[model samples]
Target chain A: MMAVTGQFMILYVIAHVLGNYTIFAGAINAYAEGLRHWPYTIILWSSRTLLLISVFLHTWYGIILKLENRKAKPETYALTRYRSASLAGRTMVWSGLLIALFLIFHLLHFTFQVIEPGIAATAHPDALGRPDVLTMVVGSFQRAGIAALYVVGVLGLGLHLYHGIESSIQTEGLNNDRTLPVVVRTGMAISVVLFLMYAAIPVSILMGILK
Target chain B: MNLTLYVWRQEDRNDKGRLVQYEARDISRDVSFLEMLDIVNEGLVKKGDDPISFDSDCREGICGMCGQVVNGVAHGPRKKTTVCQLHMRHFKDGDTLYIEPFRARAFPVIKDLIVDRTAMEKIIESGGYISVHTGGVPDGNAVLIAKRDADAAMDAAECIGCGACIAACPNGSAMLFTAAKVSHLAMLPQGRIEAGSRVCVMTEEMLKQGFGNCSNHYECEAVCPKGIKVRFIAKLYREFIKAKGNL
Candidate 1:
């Protein structure tokens, strides 16, 4: 169930991020503007909310299982020497904490408050007169610190992504040798793109290419 | 091949241990594991430093005295080989080996890689014997055991009481070792009469020793020097369950 919820979480995050990608063609302001007055904005926000809940539940299971294993088997092995168990078993708690922190900071930066006041982020119409996202992203990344922070945050997201993404697929029972490597690689590729694309906006602004 | 040994150096059981790296140069690959350690100790002695502390008497695998966590692996990665029988060729030249003691909660570090394995002796003392009167040494054919039963019993009896089972088991349960001893005697016709009582007392003693419970991880079976099967545990469990009902 933890694995299933984790997979569900990845799916939701991917969809949300892809939706956020509309800013690539337009601008950050255009994406926020899209959120403000759009056909699917309500559903977009609702799915993200559900994704947050799934992440919380999955992390909770990881913590509970670690605690149980610690009590049942405190030592790594019979010998006092060092040993490596599963990567997920060792780092799930730390990774889950980082993801939780990133979510809060992310909401504060974009959803609740426009941390940069003077950045022109008005919800304007785009190609189809749907609120454009391109301008909002460009305007937000214009601030050097904000862009750097976003890059670093996404890097943390990347760390969580690589481990969580593959394990989630395995947990969901599609764990055959033939398909497992493919799913793992695909999950990694998706996360790397998410991080790179999200970071590119800030880097572009830093390079004086935007706002 | 020559290797650097990052041996755990502790003066006593209560000492705060640290890695004291030593150059165990010119050691032979064909040398038995303890013999290589003996050469290192000889080097330490010549330099007037304290020799690296480890255990071995028979220098043969039968003593069950030598074992350490070499490079994060118990008994140095040899399948079913005791530390005494393990040769140095398995290690690569110029390897930095991390040596430490077997680390179960019940097995406290005495000094260096040696642990206080007296807990194993206690489990055996609980009921690893028959209470039958010994007037004269009974004839070997008195029990008239079949060959298969006798062979299996001997295989189970081959457990050297090394506590390797305890070290390898993730939970540190001595069930394999305890069960081996139990199965050894219980399979015999003369020993079957007291099988129920023998298993119960030993199991209770195992718990009293503060070892963790078994979780069926099978690492114990993987590292056991005697190659004892987990089936002995099943046999012990059967006798235990029956004993509980009788209680």
Candidate 2:
């Protein structure tokens, strides 16, 4: 359950990041406007519903599995030396929890506009009579603290994905001896790329490259 | 080599175990780990004190009768080696070793440094075998299995059911052991007949034995004496998915 839902969220993240790149081309407002209006809204809402369900199921099953894992090993070793398990692989629960918190804060700050209502794009329309998403996003990322927070969040995301992607593949039985090394390396590479792409937005805005 | 050992001493299954420190003096570097323990046991016997009890039989790695967590790494720090086969040369003089039994809820402590691994036996009993009609001994070349398949099956078959994989896993998952059993048989023509049902039944039994789910830590592979790969677990999942689809 965790693997399937996590893969679904990964697909959504890929699309979401690609859409986010529109901000660089100054088409974010129109993009955001198109997303909320007319037939596109149907797709938007369906995706949102699916994402919500996926997050819920992922968190729920992740918690249950973690708890069972804890119970299975009631006692810990006095001294442990990990030979193959990576640091990220060992700290999945911690990184997952951080991502959950970051997701909530991100939704409140941007999607719901509950954290900073004054800069909400929904209230201030662009010259083309569309939601000023670009203004809202730029204004938010311009802050050093928020940008740093976003960087940290994306770092957590990268760490989570570093282990999660290949784990899901293995769990789904899509990996084999011949493909294991490739799968692991590809998972790490994709995670690093996604991190750079996502972190680049806030970093560029904070550096005054995107206004 | 002299060493400081903190060995777990448990009276019985219900006793709360504690680490009791002992000084192992003048131990030869060539002696096996279990032999060093035997030396310590000899001292205890001379002193009329209760000797530290640990499990060992063949003193060789094949029997799978001896196991313990030495310095937290299952079967000690030597890679692909069981405790019985682990020599004292791996340790330095004055090295402090923390020895503990294989700890998992399913494998309760029977005594000092000994855990009851009958849970693994139960998993094996579920579906780790294939049945055949009673008849004359079949010809060896009758089943024309591919070389790759035979080699893979042999690799999986190297598992001695030592339970080190479980001890090494953070979640105490028996997926490696169970996967080895499933993969070896599933790769063979005779065992492929019931591969689907075999995987389903064995997995169910594994879960019921209080073993944890695989989280892909790959620690099991690292500590496996026979060097069983985690790919078998993936194959187990594949067989399981195929079984579910057939259902």
Candidate 1 off by > 4 Å: A1-211
TM-score per prediction, in order, is 0.58, 0.97
Compare the candidates by DockQ and give the number of the best one: 2
Deviation (Å) of B128 in candidate 2: 1.2
Model 1 chain A: weakest 10-residue lDDT segment is: A77-86
Local lDDT at B57 for model 2 = 91
Task: Looking at model 2 chain A, report the run of 10 residues with the lowest lDDT sum.
Answer: A110-119
User: How many steric clashes does model 2 contain?
Assistant: 0
User: Global lDDT of each model?
Assistant: 0.72, 0.93
